[model samples]
Target: MNTLNLADGYKVDHRNQYPEGTELVYSNWTPRKSRIPGVDKVTFFGLQYFIKKYLQEDFDRNFFNKPKQEVVAEYRRRINAYLGPDAITFEHVEALHDLGYLPVEIKALPEGTRVPLRTAMFTIKNTLPQFFWVTNFLETILSCVIWMPCTSATISLEYRKILNQYAIETGGDMEFVPFQGHDFSFRGMAGLEAAMMSGAGHLLNFTGTDTIPAIDFLEEYYNADATKEMIGASVPATEHSVMCMGTELDEIETFKRLINETYPTGIVSIVSDTWDFWKVITEYVPQLKEQILVRDGKVVIRPDSGDPIKIICGDPEAEVGTPEYKGAVECLYETFGGTISETGYKLLDQHIGLIYGDSITLERCQQICENLKQKGFASTNVVFGIGSFTYQYVTRDTFGFAMKATYGEVNGQGREIFKDPKTDDGTKKSARGLLGIYKDANGNLEMKDRADYETEAGGELKTVYKDGQLLVEMSLAEIRDLQAQEVAMDLTQEESI
Candidate 1:
């Protein structure tokens, strides 16, 4: 595909629409507001991936490395067909191709930093005077590529915080927290690329994921080595089809074969709601209890279709002593009993566990943990499969993300520009002039708008990409460590409150 075509249709004619003497355009990407409750910050991520994949590799492969005439003619052909033959000329395209590099500088907060609302997470400007339009010309693709990872990472951090609080409260193993929130979002994502990006974002806070390609993406772009370190991992697991193939009447046989013949060892997750979730939990599981307990590892039961909170923590309205009333955790406790935590919460036997993945949200997650604590069970007894319901049901506006040019220069004169629409709420009002981000005395990141050149050049933002080359690189390990530190700090603050 022609990399130039990977933009909004209206952006094609933008090169000629700028003022006659426009020499430089300085723009910043900021999250103006957050619509998510209790989430006042956004996670800064995917900037490095954008620079490496789109800015450097894509341009070099499809435009700069190709023959100038071929790419130029292709660009002209597409524009002519879309907007008539004389809609725009191809001079700028040919000139950029001849220049052999994208002339833009991108300075960004460190990947994995939790940037506060209204702060500029990154700033972009043209390096050369003639390529000022390139600053915002790249906006369409940059916004498309960057938003999902940031959104997913932010949402993932929320999940992490919830799990961490419950784990500490319930005396659960803190190391198990990373494996508690597994990414089951790949199959339900928009496409392969979206899955990889969102899945990689989820991996920032968790080590358990079913998104295999996400590991490949991190390795290729973020300097991750699967052999040397754990990127993302999943245990042997089964779906509805596997159980159905073994025949419903002989579901017990399927369990026997799996626990006795197939795996007989490490952790294995089997989807239990294929036929009768209650029967599997109350009857089939008890019939196989001896086998399950005798095995060398844990047997994780997955309930895929139900109200996740009620299903895992018991349906309160049901009969008092029934399987549906007791839920998966209590039902398992009846068969394979385990010890209690230091905090007095019931710890499920090491040989059995439960995971619920259907349509999970942060609210539901918190509710489940709250209910479990009330029922004397540790919150760690159930692992959560964070599927598309949490990762895909979001947009760029989830954090009110936008990229607007605040400062520009024309004919050697600097201009500080902004917009405050009277009809709309103040959320759309953008910052004026150059922007810089700094930490105040409270140690919270804050943005300073209308700053002079020197102030804009300093503070938390670092130059990650410049003139078509990557200036700073962060490995997956480094990003994960940084995110862990932020999460720890957040947990500390929450406790005080």
Candidate 2:
């Protein structure tokens, strides 16, 4: 009885054409043979396809952009150039055709699955036994597509958690937590594959980005939309500028220049600090303030150094510092008296706005509201101008990830697979199996694999090339969305294994 199994059922057809089993294609990897098949002896066609579609796409963009015929020719030339002209003789091609396993596709793990330690998120197997060794060269692409998205997505999710807490304390009322994280770690990623993964990180959970290149990758390889709303550009906001009358000619001129440049259009605001803030407000503000109004007659002056939460807690915008602030306070008391003027009252109400910028932590955010109650600062008057401590550096390198080879079938036996005992740190685990992504009850994920050279499950990644006529073309976003959704589901409990 013939025991050879191929993607297009070899029975009754190619049995007369080719030899079976070991005489077929295999990777040229030969270690002291363990329980399952070890990598050994690859064929030409598989190597050619891998170089055309994946290796070149990542290593050289020119490799990716060139026409398919050019790519195949280049690949063949390189193979012959390196391995010798006699290496890929016609007999090799004929032998591969006889095997009846020419193409296959890996369904793969989705992009943001919160993958735990040690799992093969991808599976690769034969499309035609004759081409099995020819196709094995695609292992590199599997790694590129799978882990890059996995690691980046995990980091982005963590960033959101920290920002979420900070936003709540700072008086942000939102229906849901929004992502404003970047794949900042992209700078440290391994290579082109990692760069693409960095972009995927944003898709799983993030809002804006400074990495513009990643945006393009998402559109090309994964399929995601580039929208202003996704990047925090849709929020309409207003701003203003003001100065203390007595700092210097330049400071006053600078403020006046800015004021003249911006009033009667958008929101108008001024900072009355520099020197004797109270005196400037009691003197210069009452008249020019009206001239500076917008359609809603609202203006915003920024608060810094002093406790910002108090500004929104319902208090006046006074000079807040050391002995210097006291001088301004006293000058105002002498110049305008202690009966807080209608100007201060109006500034604290709807017509005016107070904006603050400083070491605004979640703790400080709470204080801003608390002090507002103590100082009588209007909550609506205060608009936070948060910087440094809150916007950047949310998540560190915490998520641990690793890829493990799980299943395969070879010879007459079928079983799960794993790497050789550790001699190399983390870099030595190579795949050897038929793999698949699984979701158990409670939405957890698991990778199922048959050992190298073992019987595989029915579903395999399909290569869509029939008669060498490229039959399928998938856009990046379509794949990205698919990846994004896959990651949204649960994987195995990290602690469970």
Candidate 3:
């Protein structure tokens, strides 16, 4: 497919729709509102990835690097067939191919910054007057590629906050927080690309992920090295099929083999609910207690079904003195006694732990942590497999994300453009004219729209890409450090409050 065809059908005709002598189209990408409660800000991420992958690599490979005539002919054939013969001229396509580079400038906030709702995260405009249509022409791809990573990163940050709060309150090791919220979302995502994007978003906040290609993506685009740093990691773990292969009757022997023979000196996870989950917890675990204790590593019990809160933290509605009532954490505690933390929370025995990955949510994660704390256990006693339910079940509207032209120039006269629909709520309302982003005295980001070009060029919204070249690139470590600073500031504010 021609890279130029990677847009809505209507976009091909948009070049001629602009007013006569229109020489510039300045647009900004903003999140108008947040549907997720307590997440008033969206994490700014993935712009460098988009610029590198699509604007530079894809265009060079699929469009610019090819013979000008070949690429132009391909674009013409596609457009004519899609929109009927000669719906639009191929002059712009030829012009772009002849230029051999994207003539646009993009300015953005630092990638890891948390941008408040209604504030623009980035702005784009054509650097060449004759190529003004290029800015919004790229809008379709920009919005499509950007929103998911931002949404996933924002949601992942919320999970980080929740887990961090619980870890502090429950006397858990702070170093273990990154490994607590593991990503199990790869298979559930929209496709391979979507999984990689959202999984990398998850990796921005956590180190444990089952999405293997997400690590590859970071190494490729974000300057991360798995050998030199902990980009993302996972332990040897079993699913239902691996357990079912041993048969439900021989499940105990399977656990014993995995612990003693398969993974003897490191963390191993086994799904415990292929048959009767409670029986495995109450009967099978105790029977193999000595084997587990004498082993040199942790055996993580994974319960994949039932109410996650109840499965890991006990059910108030179940019968007393049963495994269902005691829950996986308490049952493991009974089989292998553990110590209490300095803050008086129970730390599970080193040999055994628990993880629940099925349909987990932020509210459920909080409830599980709270229930465990109430039961006198550390929040770190169990890990969470954050799957597609959290990352896949979202859309661009998850944060009301949009890219709209706010300013334009026609006949050398600048126009302040905006839209506020009288027929509906203000989520569709857009910022007017050129925009500037600045930090307040308290270090919170604030927006100033309708500004002049000089003002828009100032503030924290620095130039990241210009004229087909990346101006500023952030490494994975730098992004993580920025996020940590933001999280620390947020926690400090919360403490003061």
Candidate 4:
């Protein structure tokens, strides 16, 4: 027979937990793609597919319901044809199953920030350019690795800033500059890959996440945990006390009882004003202040309903020159009637903090900020937990993202070509030829034309795979850390308004 039956009785629980320090290494890599048969070459290709397959694990085929072996074989052939023949084999196949699709060398910005179009977040320099055809297959996976996380992260950063400004405009004094919290996006994520990406988004600016796998991935893949060393890091965590999604007198009592049981030491939060906000604030807040805020220490109060402008809304009747809400009032004490103190001081009123999760966004944040300006509450001590619209459903992220074949150089002549699509669906058009990179005075990236692929300045575009060998080696922690740094440094901010 085919001797393939020997692979039987192998209960490959591809889903089982791997041992802690187990590393899947492609040890014999050579940085050159072999000129092999049945291979294709193209610039900036397969980027979207790579992200979905490796990071997302999206393998749903209606084309056929064939055996798992057949599907896996095709994948192996494709990977080997492009990466290297020696890159993988039967002996190490099980390990490959363990690592998922590993994130290779990626150039990306941190999760929360702005990025410009037509620039490299990071580049994939194939270790094996000669194996041109095989190495080109990675274009999909490499591009997908970047696109969405960077996009969602950039947007979320602005959302929080706007909310903080709004709270200040409405007369709420900001206390903590960057508040500590967790990402509750588990219910909002599209899938495990999305969940993981969201977790990366959480780490960009916020403290931490509640997802255990996310935690494990962060540690195993990134090697950095906020709970321990980093003084400012937020190692996300939570407790399962019940909650009331409404505002009422009984609701306040219910919230109080839960607080009493869960955080007897005094640090916690309750979703106040489930029905009637001002009334609950007037009736319950003062009474529970001692036990909830003083007994152990201090707890944060969350107001999920009502316009943040009104709840922290200042009295317009107060003169601009008066304290607290006065436009000309310069000092915190002049405005709040008391100097800054820990329990009740200028800072408490001037430096107090909170989280606004109700329909918050960048534009909404800007509006809130304007409202606060009129109210005299200009403090940068709050955060916004963005949800649903942006973070939850991000599938178009095909990165639809593509790199063009800007210029192709034949034996001695070079030609510049652009795909003239019969019907342009966005991704249909692309630049023709070999790609090269250059750095400008500001250290930013610039792509230039190449008249000859046989001798281009940026070396060959292909890397990592060479002559049936893998040229470079990477660790998950290393890739994760690099991605983290790349995202953080992704600021293309303009100084003027």
Candidate 2 vs candidate 3, TM-score winner: 3
Model 4 clash tally, residue pairs: 66
* Model 3 error, position 338 (Å): 0.7
* Deviating ranges (above 4 Å) for candidate 2: 1-73, 76-102, 134-136, 141-146, 165-171, 175-197, 220-417, 422-437, 447-497
lDDT of each: 0.92, 0.39, 0.92, 0.40
- Cα deviation at 416, candidate 1, in Å, is 0.6
lDDT of 2 at 394: 33
- Model 1 stretches with alpha carbons more than 4 Å out: none
Where is the poorest 10-residue window by lDDT in model 2? 36-45
Candidate 4 residue runs with Cα over 4 Å from true position: 1-115, 122-145, 157-182, 208-212, 225-241, 244-250, 258-261, 306-353, 393-400, 403-417, 420-429, 451-497
| TM-score for candidate 4, residues paired by index | 0.58
- The candidate, 1 or 4, that scores higher on TM-score is 1
Q: List the candidate 3 regions with Cα displacement exceeding 4 Å.
A: none
In model 1, residue pairs whose N, Cα or C atoms come closer than 3 Å (at least 3 residues apart or on different chains), thus clashing, are: none
lDDT per residue for candidate 1 within 1-497, as digits (tens), equals 78999888988877688888999999999998998998998999999899989998899998899999999888889889999998888888988998999999998888999998888999999999998889998999999999999999999999999999999999898999999999999999999999999999999999999999999999999999999999999999998889999999999899889888899999999999998999999889999999989889999999999788778989989999988888889999989999899999999999999998899999999999999999999999999999999999999999999999999999999999999999999999999999888889988898899999898888888888888889899999999998899889988887899
lDDT tens digits, residues 36-127, model 4? 12111101211222333343333223112334466457656655675578554543333333333333322222222122334333233223
TM-score per candidate, in order?
0.99, 0.47, 0.99, 0.58
In candidate 1, where is summed lDDT lowest over 10 consecutive residues?
10-19
Clashes (N, CA, C under 3 Å) per candidate: 0, 57, 0, 66
RMSD of 3: 0.9
